[model samples]
Target chain A: MEKPVSTSPLGQTLAVSGVSHSYAGAQAVDDVNFVVPAGSIAAILGPSGCGKSTMLRIVCGLLRPGVGKVMIGDRDVTDVPARERKVGMVFQNYALFPHMTVAENIAYGLSGLPREERRERVAQMMSIVRLEPFANRLPRQMSGGQQQRVAVARALAPRPALLLLDEPFAALDRSLRADLQFEFVQLQRSLGITAIIVTHDQEEAQSVAEQLIVMNKGRVEQSGPPAELYDKPANLFVNGFVGHASLLKATVARADDGNGLLRLASGSQLAMPGPVGFVPTSDVVLAVRPEHVKLAASPTPGALLAKRVLSVPLGHLMVHDLLVEGATPVRAIADRASESAELPRDVFVSFALDRCRLFPAP
Target chain B: MNRNGLPFLLPMLALSLAGFVLPLALLGVFSFVDTSGSPTLANYQRLFADPFVLSVLVDTIALGFKVVALTTLIALPITLLYWHASPALRRVIVFLTLLPMLTSNVVRTFAWIVILGRQGPISQALVELGLAPAPRSLLFNETALVVVLAQIELPLLVLPVMAVIARSDGALSAAAQTLGAGPWRILVTVLLPMMAPGFLAGWVLVFAGATTSYVTQSVIGGARLIYLPQFVYREVGVLFQWPSAAAVAFVLLAATSLIMLAMTAAARHPRLAGHA
Candidate 1:
């Protein structure tokens, strides 16, 4: 098939407002709302069964939301059928047509195009995906990576306004996933199309998407730039899910200064800017990233007394599992370059107050 | 199979040789031999020359074709329903489809007779609805025979298609939907092509079953419409024409084989089957 004799496709903005869906009386997506600006990529990141994929399907018009409107560009397309949505989706398994050759599969969506243009489009897509050598080969004959590329090429061949990928790298080898992910992001950027990717892998989502929407239990837990969500999570779930963190049980303490105070279970007091509405003596879960919890052999001011249980070397850093106050398990990382010599069992764990996040206890 | 698998296969091989292959081989030889125990083409020449026998042969092939077409038409929707049905509903459909096959074909043909008889519900309904002047015997006609045979062979067609659909990746159709294809386009471009293997298998079964169905043909077809199976039975049982009966039977077999060969060839075509 040849490419169409027209200008490159322009991306369309997607706005999902108060979308909710259920299957067999069980809620799958609950009041989900987000917007992907035109020509930008957004990622719906969540764990398995978090309704991210369901939300993507609703946007693609595969499954209609039980309530709310889906706006693509300036049109309210909630009532539109999947075939008329002009959305291309790459399924988890790729779902390449087994009976069709690579070229045929890529050309399937271009049925409305002229023969010469469709062929040209197919040839262009094949070159983009680097599958020109296997043009006549069937899907089963290609390797997993090649099959994935074919799926991408097929979805892109029609020059759809938006592209949706559901766990596109879930089936690829772990070693090959990064390369494909990079390639897909490049392809999507070069095309300048609105794209949504649903994945359970946080790293993959953060790496590829400009806007990240994290979902949990059928609702969006948090949505923002990945760095913002990582640096200052909106809630405990987002803080714990977006990146690795150690949660410590603590209680809000009254401080002489305007700053808030936290009393850890280890009987150590640390002062920081606290949530305004939190009352003193209220229970809260304090979260801190491993890098922020610095380990020191000697006791430091406001540092929790801890005993190092184990240390695992990770290339340039050493991850130490420390038992703070002999009960709370806290993970801390020490620089391998500076802390080359083995340390004693007892150490003090200090928190970078600004980097720590505190949340209300459930 | 390996050496060990041969021993496991011996019992089934022995049963097929004794029950099926031996009888077929004997029938092939008998079609060539005359009553005087001499190898001759007299039987073939006489049967081929008989207009009634030739008509019966042609009618049998036509009947097979009709049954295949009707059964396919009937099974397609049922298969689609089964594909979209819930697990519990699918189980119920499976049970109902296989229920008819559990009873003997003779019993089913008798049941069809009762339904299509002059005093049956269909005749009574036709008279009551003012569609007919009186209760007429609709039992013994080509239409009734074809309808009954299609009903009998419906399960054979549905089961294979359902099995193929079950083994297929349902996401393929969803993929097609996402590719901007409407339901009708998806059916013609994606689904029907993928179902070729199952369709071919089911077609062969239904065609073979319809053509060789002696009990259904003799009971429902009666004396007016004489299919090849009924004709074979008449030549041997009523006239004691053993050589002519065997020749006619061979002709039936050859006709069925020829059609099946063409169908198989068509199904295996690269355009239809997508074999690169």
Candidate 2:
């Protein structure tokens, strides 16, 4: 694949502070705040109906926040109308102008420019998206992936300070989505435009974004690098949301400042390293990721028993759903080439002590 | 074409033969033959020769164009608003507007007459409000014809456009705005282009309804003002010229068909699309 025209154009900073919105008296996005660095790809990840859509509108200035200030660069655009904000947005549906050709759709944002300039910009965008061949075609005639590229090219044509994408790849198949994701990230990096993408998909977020902002119920649970957020999450929501994790009910057995002891449901005391801010007798939930949960071929210390284990072959690896007593099903990943793939009926599963997270019980 | 489905289509086939095909066949015969039963082009020749007839046809075409223009202007905004309305309000607006389509056209014409008559509410209000001199009729004029025809055809235009808007996935206007086009620019560049099908359907419906409507034009136009439908009605009713009337009606139908074909062709052209 040709490297998509990466020239660091120096994207502007986008900061939204204390942004909150409500629909029909019900809170949708509440007091959400974040600052996206210039030229970086940021993702706002959430589940369905979690106010991500509402927050998207607010960030783009389509809907005024009930209380908040939005800033692009150094200027405060909280009260500015959507049209004057110079923010480029790609809607979830791609929202390509159905009647306009691909060229016209890209030229739509450049209307204020002279005719020659607009045409030149459209041509440039078509080249960047590698859609020159389809420039004369309508959006309906193109595949889902082609339309998505056109949407990105159209938004990037005007060179807005910030580009907002609201789940632009939700319609594509897995392979196509992955290909476009890589191309778009390259295009975004080459263009060096600050972009904030909203998606409910964790994998897409992890693959496409350099910085991930996890949202739940109109609140920002955590905002950091995807890998950092995955390894060390702030709370229970972030732990489960950023990636798959199993939770076990536990209570504080003892604590000081450096290390804490947790009493598991089976009356076993496990030591957890942290500031153990909770009270001495307070309850907590132990969060462990699937990859960190290892299935032992033989009985190992600090290992949990499995009533039944089933390995699902998924090309490169297998997902072993281990039935741990007094806990929800624990899913562990084992290499397809390993002997652990052919597990016995009853086996022992253990968690990596260093990788476990402890959050106060919700 | 399935044997089982063929039986289900019988009622539609029967209705088409009886209601559409049979009358069209009769109109064709009548249009060709004179009252004395001689097949000649005398009626068509006379229709083309007479300046009065040509003017009436031209006036009817103009009226149809006006009807399409006016209905689109009046209905597009309302239809867009209806599309954006809450579910409860949308139901109420739909019921109120489409209620007229269910009511008899003759009844609606009479209602318009009462409203625009010399002693009607409009005239009375105009006199009382000192906007007009004494009690004058707002009916029996070209302007009055367009106004009434637009009202009668507004819902027809609105419903089809509303259907098109409802089927869209995202708010194109919002997308356009974020892309830096202002509201007016968005309307011109994005929404209007996206709504091309809606406008095309609305224009065709309003044009056909306006050009063929006899009751509304006669009652609203009164005796002084004459349109193609009124001219056709007079040919048979007063002059007792069935062949001439049938010929005129057929010409009107042909004109409507040609214009509709032109419109459909125009809709295919990207630059010319939705220009109407």
Candidate 3:
């Protein structure tokens, strides 16, 4: 992951404030607010139907917010119609004009330019996307990834100040999706265009975005860098959402030294770093990532013992689900390179202190 | 099953062949036959050489083109209005337009005759208002024929053109507008081009119907009209000149076919072909 630069010259800022919208009386976006700095990618990350797409539409001027304003670099363009807003959007399905060849589709948005300039820019965009050879081939004739490239080229050809992509890579297969994700990041960097991508895929959002806005039920739950979000989630929703974490109910034993000893439901004591404003004897839930849980044959000091219930291999890692007596299954991801095949049936698991998060139990 | 189906279908096919193909073949044969009871090119020669026949041919051709052009120009805006109209309003407009098509052609033409004729409602109003000294007959003129034909064929034109516009992917128009094409430019550059097939189909139908019209012209123009179909009817049915009537029929068929061929060729252009 690259460090986010504090500032950049190509910055084109977009601010969406208190924007609320609905469809047929059902609210899709409720008082959503965010700022996407210029030349940076801000991702609206959420599960499906979380109103992320609605927010994108409102920002692009496709849909007007029932309340509040959308500002692009100091211009309040909330009421502006989609065409005149000068915001380019890429649809999830690419939405390429099927009848037009690749070059023609890329040239569509630049049609108002002088004929010579339009042709030159189209040629330039075709080369930018490396689609010069297939310029005359219709969209239906191209592969999915190629068509997606053409779509991106078409949207970028006009040099829109703000680009909005709605689940742009949702339709591609996994391998192709990763390739396009890197390509899009590189393109955004090169062009220095501000963008907001709406996606439900957490891995995609974490990998491509500079800032992540996690949303749920038309409200922003958390917002920060992907690693920060994964490491210190604001609430249970963010903890479970950003990455795989098992929630274990525990009672805090003491509050001294900024740490508390928690007794799990299975009658095991585990050390927990107290969250800000938390006190001793308070009930709390511990969030521990599966990869941070270490598995051992014999019971290690400060480790909880459990019986091995199942081992599921996920290509490069193995997830062991253990039945800790009188408690929920404990999940641990073991790297395939370090794990031994002849592991004992009963094992003990301990959490790495740095990877655990504490939140008020609810 | 095949044997049984063929038995039932063969007679209808034969009937159609006799009713349609045989007459066309006879017309083609007679078009080259002269009046001296021998195979000659005299009829065709007369068709090309005689000023009167040539003038009538020109008039007929001009009427076909004029009717088609007028119908298309009138139908396009009306169809676009229909495309954008609310569902209820669209239904009402469609129903009203279809009323003329439902009525008999002769009745519609006579209705026009009554309105445009001397002492009819139009002339009565005109005369009553002292717009003119006396009632002037509007019957028996090319203008009256055109008005009647256009009214009669309008629904035919509207239905097909509307279907085309309705089926066209509206995204193209939106795409055009987003690309900086204004409403009128979008209509001309995108919508109209996409709707060309429907317009072509409608124009062909209207042209063919108007060119072959005998009832409307005869009823509207009375005895003075000399459109090709009326001329053919007079020659064969009234004067008993079957050969000349067949020659005239062949000429009309050739003209209509040539128009269709030209339209088909124009439709093949890359800009227009993409619409399909």
lDDT of 3 by residue, A191-281 (tens): 8999888999999999999999999999999888898999889999999899888888888776677766787777778876554346767
Tell me the tens digit of each residue's lDDT in model 2 across A1-36.
422222214488989899988888999998999999
- Give the chain B TM-score for each candidate: 0.93, 0.90, 0.88
DockQ, candidate 1, vs. native dimer: 0.43
List candidate 2 segments past 4 Å from native: A1-9, A253-261, A266-280, B1-7, B83-92, B237-239, B270-276
In angstroms, give how far residue A87 of model 3 lies from its true place.
Answer: 2.5
Clash statistics: count for each candidate: 11, 1, 2
Interface RMSD list for the candidates: 2.6, 3.6, 3.3
Tens digits of per-residue lDDT, candidate 1, B136-247, equal 8998889999999999999998887777777766788788988889889888888777777678878999999999999999889987888888888888899998888888
The true-versus-predicted C-alpha distance at residue A304 of model 1, in Å, is: 5.0
Please list the C-alpha lDDT of all candidates, in the order they appear. 0.87, 0.84, 0.80
When 1 and 3 are scored with lDDT, the better candidate is 1
True contacts kept of 1: 0.58
Q: Per-residue CA lDDT of candidate 1, range A4-39, in tens? A: 423435689999999999999999999989999998
Model 1 steric clash total: 11
Measured with DockQ on alpha carbons, how good is candidate 3? 0.21
